[model samples]
Each structure stands twice: as structure tokens, then as C-alpha cells.
Target: MKKTEKIITNKIKINDRFWGRYLEVVRNHVIPYQWDALNDCLPDASPSHAIENFRIAAGESSDDYYGMVFQDSDLAKWLEAVSYSLENEPNPELEKIADEVIALFGRAQGEDGYLNTYYMVKEPNNRWTNIRDNHELYCAGHLIEAAVAYYQATGKKQFLDIMCKYADYIDSVFGPEEDKLKGYPGHQEIELALVKLYDVTGKEKYLDLSKYFIDERGKQPHYFDIEKKKRNDTKPFWFNDDYAYHQAHKSVREQKEAVGHAVRATYMYTAMTDLAVKTKDESLKKACEELWNNVTQKQMYITGGIGSMEFGEAFSFNYDLPNDLSYTETCASIALVFWANRMLQLDANNKYADVMELALYNGTISGMDLDGKKFFYVNPLEVQPEACEKRKDKKHVKSVRQKWFGCACCPPNLARLIASIGHYIYSQKEKEVFVHLYMGNETTVQIANNNVKLTQQTNYPWDGNVSMIVTPEREESFTVAFRIPGWAKGTVMKLNGEIIDHIPLIKNGYVYINRKWQENDHIELSFPMVVERIQSNPQVRHNVGKVALQRGPVVYCLEQVDNGENLHGLILPRNAELKANYNPDLLEGVVSITGDAERIDQTNWNDSLYRPVEDKTTSVQMKAIPYYAWCNRESGEMIVWVNEKR
Candidate 1:
């Protein structure tokens, strides 16, 4: 049978082993930090509502409805994370933390089904009417996802019931029913949440409701217009009334450029793709493709950052790629990963995977410090210290990450994405289940009526050699898919120590090895992560003479902490001596770098328009590290891109 045919009948599983490690990381690294910040912010600071969401999913919720704080998508994602954590495997410490949090949520939730502490305590009278601005639906959407994830992980019904009520409340408030308000979310999260609900509950209504919002968006009686009219405020959301992109004067499909709130745009696109795939809607599919093209081909940064200008922290026109001032929010990149993955499921394509890979290695990971406390909401490639310090607009776009912002979403989101990363690894088309990511972990997915375990052992990104021990329940010949990355210069794949018919994997996209498999089958894949100097697209005018550090999917950067002086001015000479070694005592385990730290005579500051330039070039050993590793030790200078001054 064709490999695709077999997967049509089989269910793939992401094993308990991989998720166990993820839960520990989240419990140890993420939760404690967030909790500490919360304790400092809210005395009643507990991840309670959020905990209940996870607890209900873990089949541990004592109550049907989780409390107020847990009612939203933030809580929903947290729940989803917990559900994933304890799904086939259980972690005691993680569960204990979840219990503490759930009890808090139970206390915070009201009896009337009203939730959300922010509004419950802060603005009780301001519900439903402010649908466009408030995150009620967004929060509900997250709850729905958490419910589904919890149910899937532990077969729990309480959280699902709670979120179902929340979803129903949302559906009742904003849809075309009698006494319903004609509006949609200002932030487009509910649509994706509904998809999750439908998948978990098999409720067609949820799917229909999700499509309704997506279809209703950008039509007359637009959500924002109505919201403005209701509030008697003509001013635009985010204070950008003059900007056409913010209002989206053109149809979403016609709106090629990414415009308005970076997170909102990505969430909307994610919903669009979800609706498109669920219904196979042609127009929606076309719109999705068009928008994808617009973002990838035009607005995206070499590091895969989307938003350029800080005014909106959103999309601008083509070739407006500026290095000095960028508002490429980390969540946008995470959302990009979500949208791209959804697109991949709809149609087997390389572009989606390519973007997904790019965003994962650079933009998404760039959100947090290597130790995990510090975070960067906006990731900009180029920064001049004067521009950073003197420019108020640019000042908001931080050159270094900070510990927990009040508008914090990216950090937890990053943790969750990294933890649940196995979902992105293997995708099935018929009998052929494709392995797009090469991380060391054991995964089990049902393929062709039997459980197929992929014992993938590899030190990837740093090293390209991957070996997968394919263990199937029964003797079967099918297809095993491997993503050939768009960045791979050369890749080789082998099965059972015998080279398959060589499909020269250009860019290392998916290389499918279709054949019969037996017990103890071995597959070896290798892609040399050659340290290479990369030149950006010529249209990206700022990076014309500059070179980016790259090995595998990661784009490395040099910080002034390790190597000081005129970092932005320093140019890495072509064929400059390159050597890489691991510093175990460094931030978050092993870090690799090339090019010795070179120093130059300090520029003398004179009270003249132009002072006599120093003619001395002082040579010292220089080194580079991952961008995420900066700002941990001291407030030293950081450079994502360095020039090789000849």
C-alpha cells in the first residue's frame, strides 16, 4: 500500500518519555519565575485559576468550572500544557504545583459563571459591551484548548464542561442569535480555540461558530467600528486611526502587508488557516496563501522577525526591513509557527516547515534569556546605542531582554511551545508519517494499525547526524518522512545501513524514505552544520555589507560582554579563523562560538563635528554566542549582527 494510505488508518502518538522532561522544565524553570513575579505584583498572587484549568484536564479538578483567572486562553494554554505534560506520563511535582494553582482558581471563580479577575475585580460592569477590546473570548478560547488537552491527557470531563459553558457564553454573546451582539474578538484567539473544542468534543457547532467569526471579520458592521460607536470614541485601537493598515481598509486577502498589533495579526492568520483546513474553503485557502506570501517574501527579517516599526509593532510595506527600529514581537513569531504548522497540515509543503523552523531557532527562542527569567517582547536585528538610548520610539524596542513584563505572554508561550514540540516533529499523510524535526527524544505514533516508535537519537542543530531506531508493532513496509530544512547545504539519509535511492535533499526539506520496515530497523541521517557566513537579501538594505552567524537553524550573535568595543563596527572577515568549543559553565549548559575576540583602539570623544580618527586596529581574540544568551550577567552591550571590518 502507498505510505499515505497506511497513515489514513493509524493514529500517531508522542510518547510519555519526551513529555516528562518538558513538564520538569516548565515546573522548575517557568512556573517558579512567573509565580515570584506574581507574588510581588498581586498578594493573592497564585496561578490558581490557571492551575484549575490544568487540573481539570489532568482529571484532577474537584469542581466543574475552573475559577475566574483560569477562564481565559492564557489559562487555557497553561491547562493545555498540563494536559500534554501528564497525558501518557505523569509528573508528581508538576501535578503538585497544578493542585496549588487549581485551588486558587476555584476560589477566584464566581458561581454565576463570570470569570476573569482583571475585569471581575477591576471592571465588573464592562463585560460583553467591550467585546472588541476585552479578552473575554480570547480567555475562553484558551480555556477550551486547555479543556481539550486535559481531556486528551487524562480523560477528564470537568474542565471541558467548564470551558464548554464559557464557549457557549461566548457564542451567545457575539453571534447572529436573538439578543446577540454583532461583533467578534479584537484579538482573534477564539476561532482557534473553537477548533480545539471541536476536535476534542466532536461538536460540529464549535467548528461552525469558529468559521462564523472568521467569515464575519472585515465585513460591514466591523467589530472595531461597532466597538468605537458603542464607546462613542472615534479613535482607533492602539491609537493608530491615521494608519490605514491598522483599520484594514482592504479585504484581509487584499491586505498583503502585515498590519496592526503583531500578536493580533498572527492570531487572526492562525484562525484563518484553521478554518481553511477544517472546511477546505477555497477562498480562505487563497487568502491564507496570499497573506503568507506577503509576510514571508516582503516584510520578514533575515532572523525571521515579522514586524518592523514600533508604532504598531506590526507589518509595513515590502522591503521596509529596518534593523535599527523593529518591533518584531516574540509572540508573533510563535504565532507564525502556529499558522505555518496549520498550513502544513492543509497541504504538504516545504515553505510552511521552512518558516516554522526559522521562527523556532531564532525569533521564538530569542524571546527569553538562556536561564529563562529575562525576556524580550520585541526582537530587533540591528541596534545603534545612540538610536537605542536617544530615540524614545526605539527605546521600547529593547536591545536586551528583561525579567517579566506586565504584558507577559511570550515567555510562557515559548516554554509551552518548546515543551509540546514533539507535535511538530511527525506529521502523517496516509501511511507516510513525516519527521520534520530532529531532536533527541522517543516518540510513539500509531502507523498502519500498529504502534510505531521512533527512537530518534541525535545532537541536532549543533550536529546534524541523526539516527532513528524505527520499531513497529508488526511487520510493515511504509513511508517515513524527514523534513529537509531549507537551510541545509547538503543532507544524506540512509536506511538499515543501505543508502536509499538518493533524493538530493535541496534545502533539507522533507525526504521521504518509503519502504517496508521490520523489527530493529535503523535509519541514519546526516547534515553537516558547517559554520558559514550569511549575507541577507539585497533588498534588506541595512544588512548589505554585514554577515549573520549561522549553523544549522540557529543564527548566532556576538555580545560585548564576552568581546568588547565597537561591536556594531566590527566586521567578520571572510574566511576569518573559525573554531567552536563548548563552555559548560556558561548560561544554560553548552554554548558554542567561533572567531576570536578582536579589540580596537577606543574612539576618542571630542567636542567637534568630526574628530581625528584613531588609526590603530588592536587585535584580540573574539567570540560569538546565541542571541538568547545575552543580558544575563551584566548590562553590557549586545550585537546580533557584527560586521567583519576589513
Candidate 2:
């Protein structure tokens, strides 16, 4: 059986140069800042009203509910982040606050295990009536996730039991049975959350409920259609009764192409993959693989972002990625990571981890500012301040990150993901320990009757020199697999100080070192980090003549501040000498790539918007920063794919 269990965040002690800072920022800055925002106390930030709704639902206040239907998720997600932070580093005060909130949740929950603030506060009798457009199940999913995290971190069953009661109530309400509602979430999240609940409590019913939701989605007559007909009222549903936009146009097994809201699609696919792996269902597994390939090979941007168009925040078509008009929501990119990580658990494929790394380093990190306070809900590859200001359609493309969002999903989502990033670094099977991602960390793994202590040191995603030390309680024979990233070529692994003469075993982009180890045995792996030019497929019309820069896993982009405005006019020379330089003062000390390029003197053409091709150009020195590090400095145009001299 493949390894389905991943190492938890608490086990891996991160002390690295790059990712450690990010995690620390989440712990110290983002969490507190978001806590204030959730309480509607953050200065100059959009009001969340997340806490006020709970107070109203709990009968602590008579004030009406405010914000969207899914406002509760902001607090739920924040609780999840708090749980992870508890595991990373215990905060008694924070835990006390979380406990108080959980108590409020218990108070707000109805007599029948229902726990939605909007319905409880205003329309108590009309609960679960509009699951298609409303986000009841979606909010419940976040609550369940928080419950599981809190249970795992603090070993407290208060929140877990509250959510489980809600889940059991949900199970009683909807299913394939004749008396059940036969309904699922329009925004697909509870499906995956149920799987997590089952994993934690060993409860078969939660797993069965998740399977029922997946199996019922997009089935004949369409549950959403039936529900809508029953209501017979029009209130402008977000998807406009279009099943494709929510990925409910067809059954899970029949749907092949990636479609719908990117976040919803990825979250549903994650649950599907989890169920498939747990049940050993080959057909369902194949469906996940098909969708995975469709997204990564055809629909995904070079920065590992999805949701190409702004209209629906959805997948448009194959090779239809646009640079400027993109709606790559940070939540969508995070959902992509969730799905890819689950796929890795099922198949142990490097392709999935590659996408995970791409999304983590670029799309996910770019959602937040360097200061960890401001956030970008939509990440665009190309940006022009003028276009953002003047074009009504491009208004979502902000030159700077915002203080808060009305929806307010991405910031908290980023917080939880970053706080729990250690969970994605490693996994374990029967006798093998898999190293999925590299960073400075110390971890202990239990293999059968033995405890193994392993420590790793590296500056990854920037440099590729990793040194690992293995110390088991006793001499034990087990396999330790280190992932040789797909982007890495000419990788070398050495046992102790000398290179082993024996041919190393390689599987799924990992080199397996299985041996009976002593207390202080050492392993070193090196992958040369070189700046490589990446070009899109010829089918991708927008990027046919352009190239993106990549060093290791970090994608680099050209900013107008370094190359002057009108970034589209800048072109890379055929023999451009690109070099990486570590600048301590810029964007918190990133390794910026410097090179020489040419620019057309288009300023001379004062009156002509279009003219005959002229061979007039000027040589210019250009600098490129990590895609995640862009937009941190002065607002200017940015381009990941630069025009290359033919």
C-alpha cells in the first residue's frame, strides 16, 4: 500500500533561511493582524464582521448578521491557523481565546446540531434550503477542518465533538437514501473536510458521508436544479445555474477536463483523490490523474496558477492562459497545493510535488506582501498601473496588495497553509521515510519498533546543497528516500563524505538509501542551481515568443523599476549573460537574477500607435527578482515571460 499518512507540522522543526522566515512571519505578524481584522478592529482594513455574526448567533447580542453567507469561515480558518500555531509553538493566551470562541460555537449551535451563524441569527427555520448558492456546507467544512486541527494540536475534544455533531446532523440530512436530500455543496469543500474528520477519529460514517457527497455530485436531474425549482425564486446565483462553473455538469468519473471555480474544482478533486486512494478504487484514481494532467499540462500558468479568466475565476480552455487578465486567486493556488499533495500520497509522483513546489514558491507566496500584512486576492502575471486604473475589466489587477478583502478568504487561507507547511515536507510508509521537500529541519519518525531521528540542513529553492544526518535509537534497517526534484539535473548523492560506487535506487524522482544505519551516519546531496530559460508550449499563444527565467524552483520575473516602463518593449538578447546575485537590501535578501537586454526606442514615435517595423533598439541592463518577491518594491509593470531575440 502507498503511504497515505503525512508527517504532521509539529514533528518537523524548521530552522531554515528561506521558509523559516515565512513561517515566523505567519506566527508573529499575520496571525495577530488577521485576528484583529476578524474582530473588526484592524485599522484601515475592511470590516470582517466575522466575530460579530457569532455573537449574534450565540444570542450574546441582538445585532443583525453582516457580511456574506460564508463569513464564519474567516474565523474558522483563523482557528485552524491557531491550532497549527499551537503545535508549532504553544500560545496559552491564543488557546484561551480559541477556547472561548469554541464555546461560543457550542452556544450558537442549534438543538439539532446545525451551526450556521447567518441562518441561526436571521432565518433559523430555513437552514440548508439553498445549499446550491449559499455556503452552509462550505462553512461547515472549514469548521470541521478547524475542529480536527484543534483536536490534534491540543488533544481537546470540545471543538471536535461540536463539529462531529454537526457532521452527523449533516449525514442524517443528505445522502443517497430515498428520504435524504441528495444534495451537496455548490462550493465543494466539506467533501474533503469529512475525509480529514474520518482520518482523525477513525469514524467510517464521516468517510461514507464524504463518498456520498462525491458520488451524488453532478448526477441526473441535478440536485441543484431540483432545489432551485422548489424555491422558484431568482436572486442571481453566482454561477447562474451553470453547472460547468461549479464542476457539477457531469459525474465525477465522467468529468475529464478541469472546469468551474478553480478553488472549488481543486478541493473536490482532492476529496475524490483521497477517497480513491483509501478505497483502492482504480477508476476513481484514473479520473484524478486525468484531471491532474489536464490542469498541469494545459490549463496551468507557468507560475503554477489556475483560474485563467476573471469572469468566473475559472478555467477557460486548454492553453488559454492570459498574463494580464488572470484571476488566479490565492485560495485557488492553495487548493491546487492541497490536491497535488493528496495526489502525491496516492501515487508518489514527482509531477505532483513539482506543481506543489511551483505553487508554493510563486503563486502562493505572491499573494502576500513582504511585510505579511497586506494581501493580494488575485495574482496577475503581467500588471500595468494605468490599465488597472482605467480598464474596468482589469480593475482586479492591483498594483499593490490590499489591507483586506470583502470575501477575505485568501489571507487566512495563506496563513493556515504557511503555518502548517511542515506537514508537506515528508511522509512515511511501512518501512520507508519519504523526503518530499527540503529545508532546515529536525524530525523524528517511528518505524515499527524503532524511533529514528533525522536532521536536514539546506538553503533550498535558492541553492541545492543539502546535508542530512541520521540517528536512530538503535541500529535499524529502513529506507530513507530523498526526492531529486524534477527541475534538478546532474544530481549527486554521497554516503558520508565519499560517493558510493553502487548504483542508487531511484523511484518517482527519489533516490532511496536503504541501509542499517549507525547513530551519526551522514548523507549529502547536491543539485546544481543554474538560471534556466523556460518557454511555454507552442499551443500557448500568449507566450509563444517569450521566455521565463527559473533558478531551482523559484521563477524570476522582470520588473519595470529595473528596466524602465513599457516592459513589453524590453527583449532579452540571444546571448544574454544572466547571473544570480544575492542582494541583502532588496525584498528581504532574495537572489536577484541580473542580465543584459535590448529595448526598442518606441518613445520616438510620438503620434503613431502603430507603424512599420523598425530595427532601432538600445542596449540596457536588466534585473529580475523572484516572482514571489515582485510587487514588494515600487509599483510598476512586471512580466514573467520576456520576449527573446529570435
Q: If scored against the real structure, what TM-score would every candidate get? A: 0.86, 0.98
Q: Write the per-residue lDDT of candidate 2 for residues 156-268, one digit (tens) a residue.
A: 99999999999999999998789999899989999999999998988989999999999988898988878887888655556665788878889999989998889999999
TM-score of 2: 0.98
lDDT of 1 by residue, 469-507 (tens): 988888888887777777776677788898775575333
**For model 1, what is the error of residue 282's alpha carbon versus the real structure, in angstroms, after optimal superposition?**
1.9
User: Global lDDT of each model?
Assistant: 0.68, 0.89
Candidate 1 lDDT at 583 equals 69
User: After superposition, which runs of candidate 1 have C-alpha atoms over 4 Å from their true positions?
Assistant: 1-24, 39-74, 96-114, 177-179, 234-238, 242-250, 382-390, 504-508, 596-618
